[model samples]
Target chain A: MVNRLIEPTSGRILIDGRDISKDDPIALRRRIGYVIQQTGLFPHQRIGENVAVVTRLLGWSRKRQRERTDELLTLVGLDPARYRDRYPSQLSGGERQRVGVARALAADPPVMLMDEPFGAVDPIVRERLQNEFLRLQEQLAKTILFVTHDIDEAIKMGDLVAVMQQGGELAQFGPPDEILARPATDFVARFVGADRGLKRLSLSRVGDLELQTAVTAHPGDDAEEARRRTLADPFRYLLLTDDDHRPIGWVDQDDIPRSGVLTEALAIPMSPLVSRRTTLKDALSMMLAADVVAGIVVDRTGRVLGLVTVESIAAAMRPPDRGVGAATDGSGPDAARRLAAELAARDDQELGRTEATRA
Target chain B: MEAFIGVFAWFADPANWQGPNGIPTRLLEHVVMSGVAIGIALLVAFPVGLYIGHTGRGAFLAVSLANIGRAVPSYAVLVIVFPLSIAVNRETGLFDIAFVGTLLAMILLAIPPIVTNTFAGMRGVDPDLVEAGRGMGMRGGQILSRIELPVALPVILAGMRTAAVQVVATATLGAVIGGGGLGRYIVQGIARFDYQRLVAGALMVALLAIATELFFSWLQRRAVSPGLSGRSVRAYENVAQLGRVDVPAV
Candidate 1:
């Protein structure tokens, strides 16, 4: 309806306060980008031609079209030199989807309608494409209407989600955080699922948490000193680091010899190493999968910064009380209160999980 | 075996190469008749076939027309049109009775495959492609010319190949209706009891049919989109396979 592919029987669609029904549909469609689930690429055309479709229709010169095609292909993370001359049949499903997105963005339409754009790919590729598309959208900022049946995708991609119930009636409309935190109706709540708090974790990043400093020791450090330091700390494990301050592993106080130097062979394997950009949900999942109490947070250069424990993550998810500063306290009345709330929240999450499994 | 040897010996004789009734002239006549009949049948069938295929309307008409074209014997058509051509000639002095009758027969033989294949080809184009074209804001004509035609070209050409080969073989029937072609050699040889000429004429017809098949096969390959047919190596294999099934019923 937005692209004027099918005319609505009763209502008029307005774009920029102008009724699109009054505009020439071809001109309107050229000005608005459209993408569907199947990627809809013309098999007979080369990738270059597919990307430049709208540009050519708009009468761009051959040189301009070629330049734009190359630029768009590169923007979609496809190497223009390698992929431009290839046909759609030569590409993988994900590659074809990238080309589809490139084609839609060719004319740089002010509005884009994406209907399950990443739906055709596998989960890994879908996540990668979703991230790439988000990164591109950060730079472009085109007014986008993204449609997907997956609630996770809708929450992840949409700034303001418009949830529709059966029969295409709008159930609720608001920012993803609001929609997840305070669903407008019971249907909306059920649709978002009972694990809304867990889902919200995906929205927050590991960088947002106040990480605690892990007690560190080099491989050649005195084992007796490391053991003393480990016993003094609440977490009785000494993090062994290389010369560059990157984590190698952990050494338990019980395993430390009385007066010998620490060695790489003595340390147990470290927990999951997550970069600051990792989402809280992913970080927690990795920590759980590794059966560790905390994840080592690393910088871009892979140098260890600090550690993020599940307690700290749970503390972060609680309602902000005093300030960001007090939330970092490992043991206080506020921390105790937050821990109680976290326990209650975990119970609620467990209930939600069982309900989800039943459904 | 003796007739086959006699066929080669007839080709070796230089005397048979020289006049309007010679091997070369008769072969030319045969090619022209086939070409004319195919051209006329294409003009009559292509538009109707494309219309039916594109609109998806009159599907029954396409099927019924194809069935009717196939069911009517070419020999019967020749005899039927012979009287009509003679009547037209008597009324207007414009049409040649024998030529028109024979041409009509060959055209009737060619139409079924051309029409059926064109309709089937267009119908076979993925509807998703057509929908994509429409979503891209292509007008009806643009979608047909740019998207539908290119994708369906292979199947359509295969159909034309079938029709062309069939026409070439069927045009030999012109000899039965007082028309001139390589079929003259067969008719005369049979009348005079010359087995050598009969074998030579049959062999030439076979060679002509083979040449027609190869030419159209090449044309089909050239016309199809490379994306659909793949690269040259795979496409050559496809053409070889296409040859086995595309042979005319003759």
Candidate 2:
């Protein structure tokens, strides 16, 4: 209805106070960006033209379109120079999804409608694309009306999540944490799932959690001293970092010899490395998947920031228990309050959100 | 089988190459008439096909028309038009009935594949792509010309290929109605009981048809976009079935 793909039988959908029903659909659609699950890239068009489609339609100069295409592709993390002339078929599913996003962003529309945009890719790629999109969103801040059936996706993507029932009625509208913490109806509750509290873990990023310091030892450090330090910390596993402060692996305290200098071989194995921006839910999943109790928090350069342990994540999941000293940063209680305030602020904004892509 | 041996001998003769009734003149006539007929068919069929395909209206009528066209043989159309062209030629002295009749028959033969294929090509484009185009604020015209047209090109050209091949092969019937074309050699050879001429003429016609087939196939290859290259074989397999020409080789 927003782009007049379908007209509402009743009610007006206003994007910026202008009723979408009354506006010229062609002009209105041009002002809004659109993406679909399949990416819907014209198979005949080159990537550059695909990205610059709206610009070409709006009659931008050839040079200007080229510049915009490069900029948008770069913004979406695709190297424009290499991908510009390539066809959509030549790209991987994930790459094509990126192109789809870049194409939508090409015209720099204030509003974007993403209908399961990353739905086609595998779980790993979807996560990567979602993270990249979120990072891009932080920069661009387009008024995006993202549509998805996956509740996890809905909770992760939407700043003001709208839970639409089967009949297209807005069941619950609030921040993701609110919807997770408090379902307005029985339908919404079941829809959010029995593990809605665990789902709330997705709402808070690793950055929100106060990381626990892991005992570190350089490869050439005295094993006696390293074992002493590792044994002293609550987490007995020693975090091995190279000279440049990049994390290598974990050295079990039992594996450390008492007298010799520590070598790279002393470390048993590496845990899944996570960035500060990773959701606590993903970090927890990574820790479980690695069969370890902790995940190594790394910076952009892969330098060790600290470790986010299972206990710390659990501490962040609920109100900070005063008994757990690891959550001293108090992310759990603070995250809840911050999420509540964010939901309250979002309630004030009147946006008749999204059109579901059910069929 | 015995006469087939004389084909080489027929081509070797200098006499066959030099006269007004020579190979070059006949070849030129065949080329010129086929070109004109296909050109006229394109002008007539493309817009109709494009409108029906793009708008998605009158689809049943278009398909029925195409099927009806395919059912009526070009030879029958040529024979029917023969007397009508004669009447017009006698009255106006502006056209040769045989030539006009043959051209008309060729045009009629060419239109169906082009029309059906154009429609199929337009329809074959993923609706989501069209939706995407429309969502991006492209007007109906822009969607048709830019998005639908290019993605649909291989299929459309496939249709044209079917039409062109059919027209080129069927145009040989022109000589059956006192027309001028490479078909003239066939008609004249059979009339004179010159086995060499008959064989040679038939050979030339077959060669021309082969050349036409190769040209259009090359064209179809060129028209398909790089973006569609990965799955084009599969896509074309589906679309080709729609525009498939089952007309017997004349």
Candidate 3:
């Protein structure tokens, strides 16, 4: 019933512009992997055997099976040496889902259909798996159709959001931000939530944009001077740091002393120091919890890199309200079409450079 | 009552331990009859039961065949097999009527439980376990041998135990048909109204049956892991105590 429901009735379902439905279903199924919601796995079989079953059934030789199973284990971020001999009953839910994905990709499928694969795991593990999948998707470039009742998950993972209605009709279809900003109908609007604008920030990452500067102070700086700097600047806090320029803490304007050294005594420990590589979604959560307007973005060495303010987060979150026209162009549809062409040309140029490098 | 006690005391007396009327020979005959019958039943029923279980399609036919064997009373089997054995060995004139007829009757009595238990055990395996095997690309034969057989072993053993005890008890029927056994002593006692030998024969058969049952049950427990058997017992108990129950098609 599930296969029939997703089956293309009139025309072929294309992947990478190739009509694969007319081809052999065995071949098609091999190239299009699927992950069910419950991470359906054989509890009695060892994890490696579970992943290798499809490959063996497909008549891959022993050497090839070994190679492919190991490759898939690494691909799903599970060390084959550790997990190969264990059974599904012995694994955590997240690990089971990872194995599920590995098994689906057993034949090196170019397309993956995931049906709420992370639903069984706790939130922290789910988030890690989601991010890991995103990184994998970026490298593999597989055309993925991920299903979830979770609108947040849909927004976070989907490149092109396709909201399905109660009876499984396409309710809305567009980019994540566009669908969130202007839902096609009441159903979509309610589904994305009334605060859909805020939810969009979860899809944006800190690495996607440039950061703004903030007031900085050395640990040996006079407390009076740090207070004077905070009063003069628009930002309320001064970022305190060590002599080596690593961010130590921050001194709020109200907490600074008159004529003493600005040591750890005057500074509050930095609770929301997000790395520059952190997702805006994660940064926003930290900022919200800290009740601070901005987060200090640090490097690997904890150096005070820059700050992510509320305005940058808001700007990253908000979509241009004027539908498709405002999306590509600053002006109108003709200009927007030109902008799309230019972006495509730029992508083509980058591809050409990569090929040249390969040559 | 006084005469019964005197007879009992006479039997209990050490002087009559190996006395006349072939008392020692009768006890030996009883042990040999039961041991031979059980041995033959085990050899025949176990393999046949396993075969019927693996096939799984002809449950009604298999069950009917087994039930027919059981429905034929021990006396009937003895009466039927006696003449047949004599006719086959007529030229040799060496037919051991008592031993051979008792063996046939015991085999008939033992088969029903073995066949029924085997079928029930094989059928009782959770379908999900079989599906998991198929999904792992296991062939039907491999699934049956590696997964199904090992899991159903205890239940199969339980059935065999029941059949064994039943057969050992029923071997006494051999005595009435000129079949030499402790049953010969039982028949002699009844003819002369000498209750002492009759009570002794009856007690020996009861002890043997009880001992066989205990040994087989211990074997069954040892065949499967303790944890798995305990879980199965607990699960069955919970279902039984549910009060409003939907009976399954067993």
Give the better candidate number (1 or 2) by DockQ: 2
What is the TM-score of chain A, computed separately for every candidate?
Answer: 0.75, 0.67, 0.73
Clashing pairs in 2: none
User: Mind giving the per-residue lDDT tens digits that candidate 3 earns over A67-169?
Assistant: 8988999999999977875566667899998999898788777667787789889889999999898998888888787877677888888899987765446
The worst-scoring run of ten residues by lDDT in candidate 3 chain A lies at: A350-359
lDDT string for model 2 (A1-359, tens) is 77888888998899878788878888888889999889999877778889999998889999999999999988888898778766787789999999999999888999999999998999999999998999999999999999887888888888998888655877889999889877887557666766887899878999998988889989999999999988888888998899889987888999999998989987777999999999888999998998989899999998999989899988776643335565533379876785575466443322222232252
Model 2's DockQ score: 0.50
* Candidate structures ordered by TM-score, highest first: 1, 2, 3
* Local distance difference test values of all predictions, in order: 0.84, 0.84, 0.73
lDDT of 3 by residue, B117-195 (tens): 8878878766655544443345668667655676677788888888888777777878777777667667877988877
Clashing pairs in 3: none
Local error of candidate 3 at B250, Å? 25
Q: Can you list the residue pairs that collide in candidate 1?
A: none
Alpha-carbon shift of residue B88 in model 3 (angstroms): 15
Error of 2 at A55 (Å): 1.2
Candidate 1 local Cα displacement, residue A2, angstroms: 0.9
TM-score of each: 0.81, 0.76, 0.57
Error of 2 at A41 (Å): 0.7
In terms of TM-score, the best-performing candidate is 1
Please give, for residues A72-127, the per-residue lDDT of candidate 1 as tens digits.
Answer: 99999999987886678888999999999999999999999897889899999999
